[model samples]
Target chain A: MKEEIIISGFGGQGVLSMGKILAYSALLENKEVSWMPAYGPEQRGGTANVTVIISDELISSPILNSFDTAIILNQQSMDKFEPKIKPGGVLLYDPHGITRAPVRKDIRIHTVDATEIASDMDNSKAFNMIVLGAYLKVLPIVQLKSILEGLRKTLPARHHKLIPMNEQALQAGMDRVK
Target chain B: MKGIHLMKGNEAIAHAAIRCGCDGYFGYPITPQSEILETLMEEKPWESTGMVCLQAESEVAAINMVFGGASCGKKVMTSSSSPGVSLKQEGVSYLCGADLPCLIVNIMRGGPGLGTIQPSQSDYFQSTKGGGHGDYHLIVLAPNSVQEMADFVGLGFDLSFKYRIPALILSDGVIGQMMEKLRLPAFKPRATEEEIARDCPWALSGRTGMRPQNIISSLELDPAIMEKRNLERHERYRKVEATEVRYDTFMCDDAEFLIVAFGCAARICQKSVELLREQGIKAGLLRPITLWPFPKKAIEGYCRQVRSILTVELNSGQMVEDVRLAVDGKVPVGHYGRMGGIVPTPEEIVEALKKNS
Candidate 1:
């Protein structure tokens, strides 16, 4: 199966890194993947997005006009990317920064209060992981074991101690996705 | 050593240069390509491989430094984006005139001037038709994937040294910034001084008692001698064109229409080819990996079978001219592109093909 996904949020919300982790997980599964970001000045406190494509065949263009899934973290991203998701596709977002709900009826839209949960866990950095966990819960495109391996590969060894905490955040998100 | 790793195209080039036993790199920071210099700086190859990585004051300075290093027969290189490459033109010309071998990478962005720092192939004319002054040709290689981005560095150096001409990797912002999995080549040590002396006896290393002193100069005041030198360079270019032409054809066995593109545009065209095939349209892609060599023979072979051709690029229209020349009016040749940092989608390319065909 091929999954063309876009993850968008504020520059500091780890939107790009989350896409990198997803792409890396696909790599761990021996799949063909490409990760492209809305880079340059747009990456400085502005609405940033990354396109990640995981496929069994060769990926052609890293740039795309539509996506199979969009993981949006803020209202700005929701407004920009909601309509871009393909019909019957998936749209997952955090309600914390969303002012207006996704109005699309054709695609699946799910919400998780990732910010509040991350705050409750007392780690602001876990916000992205929680959202990622919710994405996994909703779609299950990749295996959880592969994601853990992806996390190990993407994170530096100096931060290995935080893996358990990250796992807790992921589990919390998976639990709260309903 | 034989493993896959996720790496950006810029980082892949840097790593490949180190692995290919490049002796030195001189470059200035530019958007979409800064990662190349940054990665090299972080690696600090000087500490391990004794490879010199210097950040020059400007792109002009960087290319001139490349000239000096390459004149000594070292595997030296420099990289920049569109505007920065424009600044290095004079140095590039001088290197060509002196017949020095070096690798120059243009990870291009949008341009006519200092345009957006987004992916663009607008520098096709500058790269293939000669951005520098004078009548000289660079061995230009366009890489579509991150793996090709890494592979081309070694191949570029090999071709450059083989012809004693400057070689250019004509990539754009998209291919330079995007990330993919790649298996890097095994590490090769830089050439020893004795090896350099043996390979390049004309290099200004030092004069042995048996041979005459060597001088590296591009200045030729005498027009007659200059014409002779130009003819000699053209002869070398002719030989390169005969032997170094490289291209990739996708699904062209029974294709009725052909799509011509290079670098990043070629990758998008591949998808368009697939889409067209799905729609029962017999379309194929001719990807020119070696742009300077132009892949004229391969393209000409397709001209007889394909009813028409569409050339797509990220620029207004540059390589399209080359396509027309190659086809030589055997079939209709049309052009489609998106400039000013906007990349055309695969659907858009298919639409253009349908319209043109």
Candidate 2:
């Protein structure tokens, strides 16, 4: 099984990291994976996007014009990527700052109020984890254990202290998917 | 031991250089490829493996430093993006003329100038056609995945030493910036001083009164002698072409249409080939791992089977010329590409193939 996923948002929204975590989890499971990021100067404050392809077989191209899943955060991403989602694919997004919702009827669309949810939790940085959780809830391609392990492997040692909080955020995201 | 790890291509290159017991890395940081130098600095291999990693003031300085290390038979390398690579061309020519074995990685960003920081395969002609002056060819390797980025460091050094010529990893921003699962090669400790002395007797390692002083320079005022050396260098390159042609083919036995590309463009073409096959169009891909040798003979061999060919690149159209020359009008060769950091997608490649065929 091959899943091509694209995540896009402002630089600080953890779009790249979200894709990295997914790719890392796929790798940990010994699945073929590739993660490509559009993160040059745009990584400073502009829109940053990442494409992660996880496959049971060898991954062909990390760069794709369309994807099986798209996790879009900001409205700019929603505008650009909503049309790019493959027919019958999944579009998992946060409803915060979205002036216009996805108009596609063919693909499965799920909205998570991750920004509001993280705001409620008083941890703005957990917003990305919440969105990631929402994605996992919709398509549990990777096990929760692998996600935590991937988080451990990806985050620097100084950030290790925040894993429990991040875990809570992931659980919170999962809960909202219902 | 093949250790499994997930990392960006740039990071893998750095880690592999360290793991392969590279003696020195002298490079200036450039975007898309900066992590190569950054990872080396962060690892501080000097503390662990005694691998000296230094940030040179400029790309020219970096290449010259590589030349100095390689002259002493040290496994040394330097890396840069497209424009930065241009800055080191003079040094590259010097390295080639002096017959030093070293690795030079061009993590190509778009441009004839400082085009873009995004990934592009536009440097094909510059890389494969000898960007530096004189008739010299740097053994060029094109890696599509982060795994190859890691694996090619050791391989590049191996070929460099084996051929006694400089080698290049002609990568683009996509392969340099992307992250993927890769198996790190087993750690091979750096060569000992005695081993260096014994293995590279031609090195000017102080001469030590054991033999005549070894002069290391590209200068020979005599034009006839220089022409002879050029002829000799070409012979070495020819030997490499005969022995070191590395390529991979996908579903070519029954293919009627072929797509020729390398590196990231080849990766996309691979998907296009699969998609075309799904639609009942017999398609295959020929991905050349070594770009310098050009895989001319392979393309020539396939001409008997395939009906038409499409050459995809991130450049406007460069390698297509080489492909056309290789096919020699055997099959109608068409070109499709996206320039200035615009990566062509698989769908686009499929369309291009359909239109071209």
| Candidate 1 A-chain TM-score | 0.96
lDDT of 1 by residue, B183-230 (tens): 998899999989989998878887766688888999999999999999
Residues B1-357 of candidate 2: C-alpha lDDT, one tens digit per residue: 137888999999999999998999999989989999999999999999999999999999999999899999899999999999999999999999999999999998888788988889988888888898988899999999999999999999999898888999999889988888888888999999888888888786767656877878888999999999888888999999999999999989999999999999999999899899999999999999999888999998999999999889998889889888988998999999998888888999999999999
Candidate 1 residue lDDT tens string, A1-178 = 8999999999998889889988998899999999999888864478888999999988988888889999998888898999999999999999987889889999998888999999999999999889989999998888888888888988999998888988898888899985
Error of 2 at B102 (Å): 0.5
Clashing pairs in 1: none
Question: Evaluated on chain B only, what is the TM-score of candidate 2?
Answer: 0.98
- Candidate 2 residue B86 Cα shift, in angstroms, is 0.3
Q: List where candidate 1 sits over 4 angstroms from the true fold.
A: none
